[model samples]
Target: MIKFNMAPTARKLVNEVMAVKPGERALIVTDSGRSPTITEALAQAVAGAGAELAIVHMSPRLMGGIDPPPHVSAAIHASDVVFLQLSYATFHTDTIRGALAGGTRTLEMWGFEEEMMVVGGANVDHAEMESISLKLTERLTRAKRGRMTTPEGSDISFSLDGREGFALLQTAHGPGEHCACPGGEATICPVRGSASGVLVSPFCIEHKDLGQISAPMRIEVKAGLAVSASGSPEGERFWAILDEAGELAKNVAEFAFGTNGACRKRVTVREAKKAMGTCHMAFGDSQSLAGEVNTPLHVDMIYDRPTVWLDDEMVMKDGNILI
Candidate 1:
């Protein structure tokens, strides 16, 4: 038997970060594809915190937004805190929505592995991460338009008009407030049909797969739709995934700047997406980000060494955040 050690980060997650008090029902929602060791660690933490722990296991979903078993949904709504430790996310499902409606705080740890619990962004100072994310949100909210460029030939522009960006903090302290653990970022939804230009990806996170861009892969967006992808064999895979998602797949769904100071590159997408100085471009599902575009999929393509400008003001230059 492999004995997986629980790191202090796991302890912080249950005790200080989430504040799972005694008597609170902390529910773990998982699937067969997920790591049992990670699950046990979380369960141990919940137990140590004096919170009643109940686990609901289900089969993995083929795609995001697909509903979990009815019993699992029921458990979520009844619990005080819900932890999603699944291979594929059910975040967009009505099941989770209902739980949030009923005021159950959630932490979506989609695609999280046992190793992640032991190290990486999971160990960061979450309050400081939140503080950074909040500051980025303020700046992003203040900007009406933004442009991103890279030396590798990525140049994209989009309108931030009337859009509000938000921080994904590790702590969820209030009703109706949920977060993703190992979280640190400010994300926004661009106005519909407002994005255009070429996006050169440095790395990508597709469903359960994370890959480095070995060759130049550029997605061409015109009026917020990715009409074509070019420059590498990976482009074919990207186009196919988008095409498989149906017409809504073309829509430029989200834009975000990573704010987790402790995160590094080439790790899980959840951690990489929050690596300070990097940014990700997501396609499909804008509803969660307060935009109109809605789709079953939300795929993020991360880029390294980005130089971003918000209406003539440079905010990020070469993978470094500037105010």
Candidate 2:
């Protein structure tokens, strides 16, 4: 059994950690490689939360496979909340999806947050992150009234009045990595991993200037997918990465509303966009681990300036939500 120690980062994760209440159970699921670190920190965290916790720890080494066992079913059934982590050599797309799919209806899942962390980021201020995340979610759910678009480049454009214009979208299904698999870059789970962006139509435009942009591009979304994109290599590369994900590559999967106000881009995707306090959408992978499974392709498009409308109500214009 690998043992994990509590460091400042671990403490921070727990500090902002919110889960089901006392007497309720929270399960931390992960691959064997991440089990030690995750389990250790979580154990300490859960105890502090006054929640009962149990471990159904599984290792890929024992079976030479990554998926958790079907036999582990009973363990999860007993918990009120399921805290899952996948910090391994990636994971079998199927294995990850199954766990999420099976748990959603089964567990209460009262509070859920998903995001990718790297190089042991212990500096994350959990409270600040959660505040940002919740604020983004809150703004998205509000309704809005907006202009129109006839995606698919149709002969006519219809107004987005009384339609769910912008939403915190999750693949209405399970996850498959390729959808947003940016080749040659370090990645988190390709599927439902991060609560990164609140999805926008390729036709929708959101703009922001946190640090710099050689030239910010304006890409177009049609039918919930990016059809036309124009910008620097960084901007276009965002699309190129998805193009390689295969057919249905541009099928939008997840839309995350970012709130990591403190994170700065590594000047590379792995360190950048995912941490931005804005909104984004993925084309291919829909996370199954997060209980969403639909498309195999998940690509994310970040919004800098957006006007959001849910149904016929106008909620946000240029990053500020009326809610």
Candidate 3:
């Protein structure tokens, strides 16, 4: 087997996706727990693209969606483009929202490992992935109701009224645009108080320490709130975490489909949720994604081979995209 280098992928991110021009100010926000090798590759790539580079290292946040320090937020707003190379996600935080609103192009690489740069999703054709994502986004935007079911007993339905779908693609060169590295998903916020039924997840990405749960975690939702959790010890722990996070944490927030064919099954959270034919549902912090709910946490639950329906149209059948 040949060893793959990360430099080429880093270069593609800087020159192709972000389109960092000469004299442009590029900022890289990383944390102590993140991979230094990945950060350095991105830094070198930015420099080679003829952009002024600045890197800021901060203590990692305890959970996803937490805000960074004020100075870091300030630096993000001041830059032309920013690379979020952190251990936990800041994509749903007000800090990133402010920066994007101020015309800073941001790329989120939360929980990204060095292996992600050379293999898996990053190794795929970005343009083809983007096309798949955008097409699904269009279908989602036009949908008013959606339902999903997995072989492991996940059956949930939610209204998509007035919601717009967001396509997570690699290109984010324009002002106020945001994307994720190794991105390929179409996501939308479900209407508040409109989700109900059971959500059974084979993998809870937030509790990655547990890895693939021995039993599927089952969550019962009523009126869009996850009323109770059961089915396994992991499910109980998941409920406890949400209970500790306050009432808003139980709100069913996001419904998304993975579109990256090269993404592996059952890997890290960032990559697993992008695996083609898979789907993930998230709870908490929908404000940044064009929804009303805002909470201290955002967690995703991934399940395999789901059959999904959007307004009577079968978009996915057993994890295969039909459209």
TM, every model: 0.92, 0.45, 0.95
Against the unseen true structure, what C-alpha lDDT does each candidate score?
0.81, 0.38, 0.88
Candidate 3 local lDDT, 1-323, one digit each (tens): 11248888898889888999999999999999898888889999999989999999999887787899999999999999999999888888999888999999999888888888878887778878988999999999999999999998889999998999999887898999998877899999999999999988665465544446777678999999999988788888888888999999999989999999998886787788888988998888999889898887888888789999999999999999999
Candidate achieving the largest lDDT: 3
Per residue, candidate 1 scores C-alpha lDDT tens digits across 165-184 of 88888887777668887788
Evaluate residue 121 in candidate 2 and report its C-alpha lDDT on the 0 to 100 scale: 19
Steric clash count of candidate 2: 51
Query: What's the true lDDT of residue 164 in model 3?
Result: 97
Q: Could you arrange the candidates by lDDT from highest to lowest?
A: 3, 1, 2
Reference-based lDDT, residue 253, model 2: 48
Tell me the TM-score of model 1.
0.92
Pull out the clashing pairs in model 3.
none
Which regions of candidate 1 fall more than 4 Å away from where they truly are? 1-4, 62-71
RMSD of each: 2.2, 10.9, 1.7
Q: Candidate 2: minimum summed lDDT over ten consecutive residues — where?
A: 177-186
Native-to-model Cα distance after best TM-score fit, residue 50 in candidate 3, in Å: 2.2
Q: Rank the candidates by TM-score, best first.
A: 3, 1, 2
